[model samples]
Target: ITGELINIINSPDTSEDEHLLSVNFIQADTKGPEFKTTYNSTAQAIRIEFSTLELVLHQGVVLR
Candidate 1:
């Protein structure tokens, strides 16, 4: 997936500014991997790599 743009829309919590939590962990009354949140129009970068060749990864996020 070279040169592929991967949008990473992190709809953080309005209160704690935390990333979206797993639906199963929340009281969403559902049983699946779901994330419901809204993001601003500030377009962010789309980075995804499985190796250090494209970019370095410390914890699933690009380390630049």
Candidate 2:
């Protein structure tokens, strides 16, 4: 998956400030892979990576 982050700043003298971040993820053919999170304050970005299976059945699974 891919995503972007933006930070907006407003000021009287300045018009506007924006910060952008882009990220991508790759999946492996493995089981029970661990993931982690990262934070960047200056760039105003957060990233997370995880591995899981996505299934699409005729009827969706029910959750309680």
Candidate 3:
């Protein structure tokens, strides 16, 4: 119930693995919603961002 949520970002347009990045340890629970990311791109760089809050109408448990 308490752990890290890992996100991996990759683009087929980029050939290098060094271009990849991730964000971790984001908190989530049944009582609250989950957060996600957005991507912004320019000619030189790609930016990833996470929001402060998310709204989920129902809380479901999934395990893999």
Give the number of the best model, judged by TM-score: 2
- For model 3, residues 1-64, the per-residue Cα lDDT tens digits are 3564533332445445434444444333434332222212212333464433333332333332
Give the alpha carbon lDDT tens digit for every residue of 1-64 in model 2: 1344432332223223422333555543333233232221222334554333344432222331
Query: In model 2, what is the error at residue 49, expressed in angstroms?
Result: 1.2
Model 1: how far residue 43 lies from native, Å: 39
TM-score of 3: 0.18
Report lDDT per candidate.
0.35, 0.34, 0.35
lDDT of 1 by residue, 1-64 (tens): 3666655543323445332332222233233344233222323324333221233334444544
Clash pairs detected, candidate 2: none
Model 3 lDDT on a 0 to 1 scale: 0.35
Point out where model 1 deviates above 4 Å: 10-61
CA shift of 62, model 2, Å? 13
